[model samples]
Target: MKKILPLSATALAALIALSGCSTDTNGSSMPGMDHGSSAMSTAPPTNVGTETGADHNAADAMFAQSMLPHHSQAVEMSDIMLAKPGMDAKIVSLAKDIKAAQGPEITTMTNFLNSWGESTTMTGNHSMAGMLAGTDLDKLKASQGTEAAKMFLTQMTAHHEGALEMAKIEVSGGKNAEAVTLAKSIVSSQEAEIKAMTELLATL
Candidate 1:
């Protein structure tokens, strides 16, 4: 029979150490590879795809609804210039081409707007088609001879530029694929016309 003394603290510590306490060879606390290294060792988790939201639903529609009649106005102006007397053949030829190209487009886009249930007349409460400012149309109506040709070219060039600008806005901001395609086509065609007009302007 023996009286047992309470275990010393040093003896208990040694007993705990012997029960598999571990430390790095370099005296670091980590018993295995560091957390950062272990984390890096894992294969990167697969990424799930993300959803992209739609943009410019109404603005795209409005731009299309507005631009069709604007294009028609340009075609109409070209027709007027073509019919005017003493017009330069080069200019007249360009006017004819513009009218021919644009008239069909007017019909096409108009059909699109109609199908979309948009307003057709430009003079209503929600007028989108700018049917020419009154003064500008009056000036066009009064012009004749070389003056008419010059005026028409000048006006039409500006008009085409305006369309191109609208087109560019749609290209960058509008989400409708058909509208964007049409806008890019407008840019290409109008830029070519602009170059043609500039050359014609130099001659006059």
Candidate 2:
């Protein structure tokens, strides 16, 4: 005759422990069992802060797209003047200002485009204000001494004016507060630069 004994408390506890130690089909530790480390230990923790998305409209998109190349051409014009010999100290200083200010602005506008999931390139046949024709750039590049400085001032004044026109559109129509702020800055700064260039051109 065989005698069957009911499972003891110690034996039941052992069974429970074994079941808790069992793993899933994917080899991950079963729930309620501590693996002695965080489950996310395999990868470093990420910290994406509480940042909300930007709210932009079509006008904001247009402002970024148009302004990028406008600023780039301004930088290019500044470079042309900087590369020349015998530039006036004031003119040189202005060129440096344009380069310093617009360089960061280009990056800012690019970020606006990226955040909006928009293309950085302008769509359709858009004409930018204050843009130098290829021949105008060639003319400016070929000049020397005071002539180069005068040409740069003349060209940049017009370029800045063009920027003002575009910026006005952004100020009036843009939805993003940041873009409008930048537009206001461009209007104020470039207006002052335009006046300074006009005075400098007279001296040249």
Best candidate, TM-score-wise? Answer: 2
TM-score of decoy 2: 0.74
lDDT of 1 by residue, 142-166 (tens): 8888788788878888888778777
| TM-scores for all predictions | 0.65, 0.74
Stretches of candidate 1 exceeding 4 Å from the true structure: 1-56, 121-131
In candidate 1 the C-alpha lDDT for residue 191 amounts to 94
lDDT of 2 at 116: 74
Superposition TM-score, candidate 1 onto the true structure: 0.65
Residue 89 of model 1, lDDT score: 90
lDDT of 1: 0.71
Please write out the lDDT profile of model 2 over residues 170-199, one tens digit for every residue.
999999999999999999999999988888
Flag clash pairs in model 1: none
lDDT of the candidates, in the order given: 0.71, 0.83
After superposition, the stretches of candidate 2 with alpha carbons farther than 4 Å from their true spots are: 1-54
